[model samples]
Target: MTVDQLPPAPAGSPPPARPGAGRTLIRGLGQLLITAGVVVLLFVVYEIWVTDLFGAQKQAAATEEVDEAWAAAAQTQAPQTDTVVVTDPAQLVTDPRERTPTYQTLTGQGFAKISIPAFGADYQFTIVEGTSDDDLYVGPGHYPESQMPGEQGNFAVAGHRVSKGSPFNDLGLLNSCDSVIIETQDDWFVYRVLPMPEEIPTWSSTAPTRPLCADVSVLPSPYEQTVGREITLPSDYAQILPVPGISDATVPADAQRLITLTTCHPQFSAAERMIVHGVLTKSYAKAPGFLPPEMGEA
Candidate 1:
């Protein structure tokens, strides 16, 4: 057939480029990205709001369980208490060994409540017997290896700074001398954050928290009172030492009772850790018809 006379080539179907596998793949990839984005948004929601709600519920239940246990301990009562009257907590409350109530338990169940007035007068959480993932998911978790509250060693705890109820969300806001109280069925353990070393008085040859500082030097160093503090890497475990940051600290003898509060640094990221160190300034025994003055504060 001559060129002009050739039967009009069938207007062939559009070329492959016009509507091909590549276009379909591109469309599919776009859809996948959109779906992925939605999934990420949903996950963030679950991490923030959902986890807090769920954690609040879990903490409520945990507190109930702990309270019941406390009741049992209260009822079983040792009618006798130490003859030593606490005229002033800063001095009288000091007991190098375990103090009144003998409140220490290894069960996963919470045995006490942690109240940080700085966080808020109403802020409180149950402290369960471990810092394991499962333990922390419910509430603030006490390090299994750490000492109990009011003990003459590092009574350390780990909590979530965000999500899982964000129990320690405002931990960084805690200033020097701020109270980090622990209430057991038997006693009220009040610990004041210790100041940084330089902030300590010139008289103390060792860490002011240990070997017992008679003055206000026991409270957190002035540096710690600054609005925002430095973050430490996870590998920096000395923050929980008997005398925080002092690995060779002679605990119980050279060291006074202390508490170490730890949580994730910043907000959502776990890149580093936030640590708060305190000295046991008050150990008021929980007795029949009695509450510490701090607890009574409105």
Candidate 2:
């Protein structure tokens, strides 16, 4: 057959393989994927570390600003009863549980300091008045509608568990009797961590769970123990009550002074919320001299 008419190359003639082009495309794609993966990794690091650094700086500044405000207010006028300084161990300030706390405008305002030795002596953070996202990123944010620290009712607060300084990252470390102290402008309010019973009782007397975390590690805690303690669902608003987990319980007026510390459960996911409930066992006024011995209970 004439060259022009040469039988169309065998039906199975393999097309010339574009090995160079294929390898080039594959190399380019591989690089692109690697670049994307690196970006993702960097973002995660930022969330876990850089954001923490920035949030911590903000928290420190907030604390200083709060102190300055108190100083300014003290100079302008006699300190209010709320801030009355008391040094007598015999005159321990009765927790203001019987009285209704008054907070007019505290959004973004640092009104108090929260210290949990269980989390670390340096675990203290400024507590602002709102629980909104804007409020929590700086540090722990108090439930606006809840009672103020040392107030008779519930003083509930929310915080990040794994990001933005992870203020409540060590929440699971709290055990019954662990001290959750709140240093307000006027007083040092101390609350003891109370056991939160599980919805379902454990088969054994000891709850199956991990021991209270001893440190403020940012990683997810491994609950090595088999405690029957049930993790509360984040949606349970009752968890924040002055008398938590009690729906029909008495209102704040007739209830014990309570404090609730809340954070997203499971470390990273917001699928659930971790709640720590405590009762005010002792309240002390801001004493200029040596602190009460009992106040130093370790």
Candidate 3:
């Protein structure tokens, strides 16, 4: 019989297996997948371990240095005054040069520490100096135009609520009459929290003025066009203060120097902001009497 007609080689010559083709293909694909997985694992490890660990260590060292610098400055300028009075809020200053070594160190190391016992905040944070686009997610922000901690108008600080390192995590838990204390290398300032008016929406409100409802409706006015309207201060009377949308003309007048602590509300979402307003009660230099346990001999 002719070869072509020989019953197709008993119907099962094993199809002449493709000479290592399957093995070579599988080996190549396996190697590619393994390489990709290894690369991904390495990146995740770096992010979870190296970045966080090294970053945190660097920040801590920087903070210590900043604290030392601030202590030195206070010693030279104030000479450990027996008493610190807050008679004039406008006199308080946040001199860049006077920042504690800790402040400078943390700031340079990509974080800043913000502690307020009233709100239960004691965390290291990134610093965002303003409320603009370039200022989000970095840290608790310091309103540059606002007064310092002991200042008269309002020293406002804002931070994330649910971030792992939430610097203002407990701000929402504060009740009226709570004690809010902020500390640095040079001084510790204490404040008394107060209740904000119910009708005053959170600072996250985008309305041009206070919003009004049927029982608490806002009145229409021409002052809505004013510039710097977004700037809210502790001294602003409820009636004239820009509410984003609601209007009230008979709110109580502002009297005391204010310090406002703001953080994201409802835990994980940025949908709203919780605000804790306080009035400065006392302040003292960071002497032995004012130092925390961890501060050592400072």
Candidate 4:
């Protein structure tokens, strides 16, 4: 059995691992991580961009419905006898329960238009009737229990700060004295953001930064403790009362015609709430093709 037929070598341990095997495993892991990142990015895009498109469509449709309703009502509306000429806008609402005449609205119904001049002349959204997520998906939604626009109570509204049209995305940009205009079937109401508590102490030390708040009244007593712009938890229901921070049953007769806007704070996070309060400073009767001068303010 010379070298002509060499005995078969016995099977031994598996071949030593390849030098590039570790690198190959790392590359595969990197690919997996990249894919996961892309998926997460897509989800964010859908939430921020895709949802905005849908929200814009809903807002447009709601705006059209509001326009049509106003036009139709104008043609068929009979003259009202109870209409009282308001010589002073501050005297607009002596009673919190008294509201300007408006057509009845259902949940998710569009009843008004809100424009923040600080945002831009073109920035406007139809104000809907309820605060449900479904209602806010269209635009800023009114708290059903709160007073209507220009009423003597809080005209509370809520909107998404990051998505779904993001009507209130720049709420942080609005400081004291900025105007928030609301239009109804027959009237246009202008509300000026109130001064923050810090500013209120020095509000009179110098001339007001803007003329809107020059004659503005400060939040009284209990409300004085509340800031014009506040960060709070979602459970603060008193923020929407007739007189903010005051009990509904104990709302003073002189309760202000205030407007409160709420949105998620810190943008893209719902861990807290941001609120902005305003007071009605002026009101105008709606006329054909006439917009209030405040609408152009920034």
What tens-digit string does per-residue lDDT give for candidate 4 at 111-137?
999999889889999999999989999
Which pairs, if any, clash in model 4? none
Alpha carbon lDDT of each predicted model: 0.70, 0.68, 0.47, 0.81
lDDT, residue 26, candidate 4: 70
TM-score of 3: 0.47
lDDT of model 1 at residue 128?
91
Pick out the ten consecutive residues of candidate 2 with the lowest summed lDDT: 217-226
Scanning candidate 4 in windows of ten residues, the lowest lDDT window is 88-97
- Evaluation by TM-score, superior candidate among 1 and 3: 1
Off by over 4 Å in 2: 1-19, 77-88, 95-104, 196-230, 246-252, 289-298
lDDT of 2 by residue, 100-217 (tens): 4332446887888888776655567899889887788778999877777887667899999888988888788766657788877556777776544442143133424433322111
The reply for model 3, stretches above 4 Å from the true place, is 1-62, 78-113, 118-139, 196-255, 289-298
For model 2, name the residue pairs that clash. Answer: 97-152, 173-213, 207-227, 208-226, 208-227, 208-228, 209-225, 209-226, 209-227
| lDDT, model 2 | 0.68
Summed over model 3, clashes come to 25
Worst 10-residue lDDT window for candidate 3 reads: 211-220
lDDT of 3 by residue, 1-298 (tens): 1221223445646665443776667667777888999999998677556645554454455557556666676677677548665443334534332443333322223222445443323433434446443343445665555555554445666665553234566665554445555565555555555433542344234233422111111222332321111224433333122222224422223433456666655666555555655655555545443433221211
